[model samples]
Target: MSLGAERRHIRDVTAWQPRVPGVVEVFHAHYTEYAYPMHVHDAWTLLVVDDGAVRYDLDRHEHGTPHGTVTLLPPHVPHNGEPVTEAGFRKRVLYLEPGALDTSLIGAAVDEPDLRDPLLRRRVGQLHTALAHPGDELEAESRLVLVRERLRHHLRPRPVRQPHPDERPLARRLRELLDERTAQGVTLGEAAALVHAHPAHLVRAFSTAFGIAPHQYLMSRRVEHARRLLLAGQPPGEVAALSGFYDQAHLTRHFKRWVGVPPGRYARTSASLT
Candidate 1:
């Protein structure tokens, strides 16, 4: 098929992924001839250009992203985008909710939308890749930290962190509760009540101590539970329901997303390898 025909077979992935807190949407697209209308997003729009280039007008100023460039479009900024090359462009875009980046860090990006740091660019790309797979929660979070640190280093230095009181005990307790109620699932409020803290406070504390959100930690654990059950020869349907997922399809969705393959494929592969 011609490149144009091949492009036709592909569809733009404008998925509203809530994989992480403070993130609203994740977009991945390859376009040969596409243009966006002048619009604004309520969340920060971060773009990672993989191949080719994109031209856009951000806040009334024109900008061009060359191949391998990464750009940050702050929230509420009006912008429109179109391809700058014949091959068009392939990009991963993130729509992050407010508070993902501190107010202080945003100004630098406003003055310079396209960043030149290779490390920052690389981590952004890695973040996207990790988010697409299963069991990559830690990697994704780690990349987020590095990306933030890199941005801070370039824009303005943050005060060095000192030793702080440990909150691991609370984090551990929350994890235990989640494990005990895996199938039934504990609401954040229930977890907070069990821990004798406000739900919002509990979320912040748990994430601070563990480096991953409570919901994410529970999700990873459930996926782990399903893996064990699957390895023991349980069918996907049972694994799904038993592992806190509503049904087989629900389980398959999170399973493949976190584990890199569907449960059946994972089981069959493991059997062959063994």
Candidate 2:
């Protein structure tokens, strides 16, 4: 088999680790002829092909990326990818932490790695978009929660369990924790552990009690903190660090969404008033 042409045309490949919880890595690739060798990953592989298609073998069974589908390759499973056409393929992948999905579901994933669900495909696409932008961690995290839920739904269908009796207390505790760590913030997993609840349940409790998602609530609080810092004349970049944002862009995005102007302009205008 000729590998030279394929090797030379392997052009686009990008990978990074975002700060969002439950995600280990994000990768995007475009290739016309490149093929992936049989390999195993320690994390769960959630993949979607944006253009073209991919043919792969998981656990000795052949699989392909059909149009409007999401593929979930379980951890420790061996897989390989090949181009399905002369046009090659473009794909975005999320490597989820092992804990993101239960290990027992590995069997189900290996049995049916390719899922034909339009909602899952769309949600995965939205997740990739969120991951690509630096200031969109909150959005990314929120989308990830939904994506995980959808994946779990496919791998193992379960009945909806009723909320526990202490749901209100759990929400109140989460709110208090958020108040105490507004500047620092907290991951849903960490908050759940501290509050003695499951991560999904914790999100439900908080949102039900406050009518806002945890990430949205946190971003709003950070924006409020940034406002105070801007009024005190702190630079936007510096205020971002003090306000618990990933960077100035992150701070500015939320600040403008919550406030009416950018941090610099807001600071200047407030100074004029004083």
Candidate 3:
């Protein structure tokens, strides 16, 4: 199936049951007029907004999410959400148990250490696939292996960084743009324009100063906003759009690839905890 069709199938199946024990349930829901209040979950809650904008409060911080965004909530973090307008909202939720990851695999060993890192999109994809198709021990083992390899690769040490006082002006401008437009999605060229430099020059400077490219930094900011919305109870489709993704499917593709589960499943599992 195409990625879009596959995601729809996954979303449909996820809404059926709570899925595996200790593995948590994945599901989707729409809030026409109702909304979820502040609540906490015993399991990790990951999600994406699929439709309208959802407003959320996480640890006293508030966020407004549109569509095509992914959200991640660590276990037990107090959060709540509601629709921003009368249109209501739609979203996906996934619940994940502590230690549910297969530590026997090398990638699984490092999963926890970097769970909060925004760059783990691929790891999330593997976990989602494993949960989507639960079966024999051998298949599970293979999934674990894939997770291990990915984690191992991620955990490898990289060269240390040195502070650059010279890049402060550019860096500050980049950060401001990220903070203001994270939901809108900022491109490298656009970011560079603010600093009166070429995209390539800005990218090189950003890498040397922050150890990552400009676009990666922007994605991290977007993901952070998405997380805040999920905790507040925004739907996946809305979150995706707000986070600069093209659509629900686009957001799901990246969210599952990064966070290990679809957005709707994350929200449903989170709601169930309350």
Question: Distance (Å) between predicted and true CA of 224, model 3?
Answer: 2.1
lDDT for each residue of candidate 1 in 90-209, tens digit (9 for 90 to 100): 788776766777766555666678878888888888888876665676887777777767766666523322113666677668867876886789888778888988888788877665
Better of 2 and 3 by lDDT: 2
What does the lDDT read for residue 257 in candidate 1? 57
Estimate the Cα RMSD of every predicted model relative to the unseen true structure: 12.8, 15.9, 15.9
Candidate 3 Cα RMSD (Å): 15.9
Number of clashing pairs per prediction, in order? 2, 0, 46
Model 3 lDDT per residue over 233-273, tens place: 78988888877878988777655543446777765665654
lDDT of 2 by residue, 111-161 (tens): 888999999889998888888778899999999999989988888733322
TM-score of model 1 (CA atoms): 0.53
lDDT, each prediction: 0.69, 0.76, 0.56
Q: Mark the regions of model 1 whose C-alpha exceeds 4 Å error after superposition.
A: 1-10, 14-18, 156-274
Better of 2 and 3 by TM-score: 2
Q: What's the CA error at residue 186 for candidate 1, in Å? A: 40
Between candidates 1 and 3, the one scoring higher on TM-score is 1
